[model samples]
Target chain A: MTERQDCASLLVQHLGWIERVAASLSRRNGLSGDEAEDFASWAKAKLVEDDYAVLRKFRGESALTTYLTVVLTMLYRDYRVAQWGRWRPSAAAKRRGPAAVRLETLVYRDGYRWRQAADLMHSRGETDLSEDELGKLLADLPAGSRGRPRQVGEAAMAAITDGADAEAGVHAAEAEQERQALGTALARAMQGLNDEDRAILRMRFWQGYSVADVARAMRLDQKPLYRRIDRLLSRLRTELEKAGISRERVRVLTDEDAA
Target chain B: MKGRIDDAERLAALLEGRVTDGERAALLAELARSDDGLEILGDAAAVTRELEEEDRAAGVLPIRAPRPGARPRLSARTGALLAAGIAGLLLAPLAWRAGRIPQGSYAMNLSRRVAVAGKGLPPGVGSAPRTSVRGADDGLSPGARAVRLGARQVDLHLARIAGDAAAAGAASRDAARLLHAVAGAGTAAAVYERAAAPAGEAVADRDLEAADANAERLAGTAAVRLGAWCEAARFAATRRDAAFFRDTRREVAELAATRGLPSGAGPALGDLRTVLDGGGPVDWAGLRTRLDVLLGAAGG
Candidate 1:
């Protein structure tokens, strides 16, 4: 095959991971998968366009995996900061300065650190921990944690671009199991949403309305439902993404559009 | 080119405030050529998103937090408009065509115009202040052309309950002016530093609709817990405040639990419990050591 075809084949081979990462990023950032892809593509283009020869000087200074993770993370952080720098910490969170960043922020900043926080609290003998367990551990951390951690997870390391999925597939089953556990916890947290928000969620995810359709059905006008969905999903996705569910992995309810 | 820096600064100021359609047309017409101008627009857009995100995260919602310790955000209508504009700009390079600007750059462009246009206006006749009985003012005219054009562009839904196009347009000007006054770098910032600041005081006193009021209130209450708890943590740093700090932490943690939040809030809240339990140092300096251990413990 020609070089172009080879490249196309490689991209196709890894499309699943791209969607996964795209979804995960979207859920983490209160953005859509499409939005996430815009940044992901930007990263890929930068990768292709930049001369990697610059790294030639640092040959053996650190593991290439560590170095690459840093670069990808830095790029992601730049995009995130650029997109939403004005966000202050949550009232509860802000008061805890140098305290742990939000779970989503923690995931973006230090991928597995929040998870570690969760584990720490669990080990401390807290019993009957519920969905809010994630919150407990981070809060328990010492004040002055200052800023999001930059350390990422195995899943994050695997999904920056096209074809990283196959390599990651070897571990997808394990990751999915983790996501399942988090998903259950997330579902439990759903109880807190107000009725209107719950209704909107039901319409979109359960009733299978297009975002536009949901807007129309609500009769009020505009995409209130979509924004609510995005925000609500961002909260849930924070835990789920950290666990392993890629936003791109959404299960389609039907194949009507395919026909 | 003699006025490049001045013009750029002016344009940046305009972008920072709200731009009327007329102001937008004028600004877009002026800066379409320079690469620097485009960069300014892009940077402003990025800054605005960051600002809004920060706003939302800070609990600037229209909803009340049913439970305390929630973050409120922009109303759904406002959110949709802003989100749509953002999504459009990101997806479509077509939005910014040759010599014509994309309309979505509202925060940067519109906010700036409102500020500049209102700069020296008298109090009652402030820039775009209510077109109260703009009776025929809504009609399209070459003179009122810019305003008319913007009126049409304002999505009817979000503004319908708000007021007519003219009224909403007027409010936009006021809101923009206020926002730019605070966000702007010049004298504008100093003047509106406290006045017209967006932060709300009480959840019930907020302008949120019925659906959102509860969630917003919860978040507001939580904000208090967060602030108090955090302050309690900080003040305990010096010589002997262990019991005081522990009691305060417990208060914070229990508050979180009652709201159905994860319960490391107090008494046994978080890694503090671990540190204290293990007989490790419990001072402020020891906080980091305990936090690090928690951060490192992911069941691996």
Candidate 2:
């Protein structure tokens, strides 16, 4: 048989398998019945596109069914992304790697709480970060208007930002300036450390991974990692002191309720 | 370009649970080298699982039937005797559980004889379905029996290597039950060891073909068992069940390096041994793929 004939024959033989796989994909992505049928049709067309380019990619190393499943899955993901526009991670999250980006997407875009996002990530073996760690990682992230929207009325907003009284507004301005100064000092101190030390700090404190997890991921002994983190913290404290940021001031700035 | 194609093939094999230990390790290493690779692995797995669920719901078999022809011939009397013997073996466990047959009694002796007799049967007879009724399988041709057994083995091995403790444990029990049915209370390991031993001389082409097919089947079964144990170890490691992980790892290493296995199985086994001994994180997915490939190659 000619190549086209061969492809057509193969497609006819595996049509049931293809539709089953497509339906499964649609169900997983929460497609309606009509949408699922549409997806199946789209998948069939895509398979025959470019003269069965996707189907022809099979190399016979694995079972024909398995190869087709992987191909169809990739196609399904593409279809979902095109239709739903999956949440894009910010450049900052991207820099932290895929795990961080996924966590951010789950929380900021998908409306999951920090703990829920961390739990999801852990279940998928994507990240081992605790909820607190996930919170810390995104603490400095530029807030997006996706999940947690502030819907204060004009009066409430004015009372809070402008303040009900002038004295209250002045006190708030002073506190904000002090908080920014402390944040700048903390960043400067972090920059003084080596890359590995910085990463260790980030994993331990910023990302909220437990000591054991960080040690395991980095292939370090637990006891040594614990000591190393302490030493790094001391170094950061010394740097902050040099920058005129006192330990007391740092504590107040970092205090959640105080802020 | 070739590398990408090879990786895709490797990924497909991994997804289908058909890779050897070595290929699994290589693919995992490749995936671990980049975030994109990990993302792809996760995505592929997620999709494949959904399809598998659908397959299960539709009552589809995990594996296709054997190719047509190549049936090993057996006399009618022999088929009947084998079927009756296998049926007795299947019920031996229940008899033991019911306290009707004591350990190492008449039932045990009878099972040992049946096991020995079973060795002389066709290559795929070792994997005969546990659900077969007495005299029911006797009516089918040897090729049909082989197909039925092959499908059953695939399903069993897939369950064992499913990466869930409950499922793997249940599969182990089923496998044990099958072995117990055959050996009349013999340990599963003993049967596996006997099966893994070198085959005797075959005088005729037909005998040689049967021996070769049997050897391949045994090897494939061993590879699947190894994969299952490795998967168990991986699950245990995730749960920090050190004892279970250690025990399963040791078992896998021993099985992989068993004597008289095909030379084709050496590289994968060797790689598995190295990984088990490395004292580092085991790439269970990679090891699973490698074993899958070995099983597939063995015609399982």
Candidate 3:
């Protein structure tokens, strides 16, 4: 057979595989059946474009099915990114790995609940993390935007300025000073940590990842990691104390309401 | 960074389930280090699995079916017994070869033996755990030693199958001695459990059952299926015939379901079982590749 005929025959033989790949991508992205069919058609056209350049690249070192799977997946990623702007996962989620990125996308972008996202991830074989673990790892992320940003009304803006009394302004200034002092002390304390220790603290406190999640990510023992966190906390507290931040002051500054 | 050509090939091999244990391990490690690689792998695996499920539902046969009137092959049991006998015969020569090699050359010889057996040394030799001539050598953890010895066992089996009697025999003796040392140090499973355990917590043999139970809950039924698939793949590797692989695949499908696998493994495991039990000429190569990707995800 001629090369074009050979390529055409090959595509015909594996059309089902191509369709399945397109269907899978569509399902993952929550596209409708029509959209899936569209993707499959587009994929086939792309494959046969340039006189079947994609098929010609196959060296036969790996199975044709595998090569095709990888190729189709790459194409799907490009297709999705082109249709919708790129989905950017949070920095913390990215650091935790691909499963975390998928979870974040499902929860934040797709508006799935923690339970639903975890279930989907499990069902799809995308992750092994439990729902509770997923929640802890993602605790630091802000809630997804439920709606578009709206402008503040003049009445609301007036109320905000009108409510700001001199006494309150004075207290706010004092609080801000205290916050700065606390931040400087904490930054200095953090500087003393090695890279891994710093990462542990960042994941645990800053990113709100669970202790177990932190241990798993760092490949450290959970019990020891707990002790290490405690020890690190104590050392930081001491450094803050040395910087003239009292225990009571530190507690007040670190409280949820204070932020 | 964009994936290199070799990365694509490795990913393809992984998806196809044709990689050896060493190749799987090395590829997994590399994937672990790269988010983009991991993302591509996850997508490919999900798509491949879905396709398999669809194929199973439609009762689609493997692309490469056995030819009509193909010569009947040995049963899986008979092939296994033949493999065992061949392995047994290589032991004497392995022992003789072990005696001939100098003690200091054990590490080099082991790598050479693995290469000779047709499985090359794992990528990044500097990063691979160095196996001393004796297990008593300091600085090597029991878990690390177990892994090294495990690789040796696989290499020896491959060598035996490849008919490299000298390499197989030498590997057999080294494996036996290392296994003995490993037993004295600690059971390999316990060593692995300890390594996985959190720091400052002692993992006694008694606690291993509890640990395993916890792991089962965490990993779910898919992990169990993956483990069974790996075992089946190892067995089928010795018997390259289509019929033997089909039988092995069926047996694994049954074992995966009947073993009281937890529900937490969810629809994914169920889908996989359906695919395995589907009536078709088994695409043994494809099944193996898909299992490799699953196994990698399970942190095997």
Instruction: List each model's interface RMSD.
Output: 22.4, 15.9, 13.7
lDDT by residue for model 3 (B264-295), tens: 32344455556566766444445544444433
What do the candidate models score in CA lDDT, each in turn?
0.36, 0.48, 0.52
Clash pairs, model 3 backbone: A221-B198, A221-B199, B16-B289, B17-B288, B17-B289, B94-B169, B94-B170
lDDT of 3 by residue, A126-148 (tens): 67788788888668555563222
DockQ for model 1 equals: 0.01
lDDT tens readout by residue for model 2, B126-156: 2321334223324533222232233333333
- TM-score, model 3, chain B versus true chain B: 0.28
Sorted on TM-score, best first, the list reads: 3, 2, 1
Which candidate leads the pack in TM-score? 3
Candidate 2, CAPRI quality class derived from DockQ: incorrect
Q: Write the per-residue lDDT of candidate 1 for residues B149-254, one digit (tens) a residue.
A: 1221121112222223343344333322322312222232222222223431121211222211221132233422332233223223211234334334555456
Is 1 or 3 the stronger prediction by TM-score? 3
TM-score winner between candidates 2 and 3? 3
Against the native complex, each candidate's DockQ, computed on alpha carbons, is 0.01, 0.10, 0.09
Q: Which TM-score does chain B of candidate 2 obtain? A: 0.27
The 10 consecutive residues of candidate 2 chain B with the worst lDDT sum are: B113-122
Please list the residue runs of candidate 3 whose C-alpha ends up more than 4 Å from where it truly belongs after superposition: A88-142, A145-259, B3-7, B20-26, B60-82, B86-300
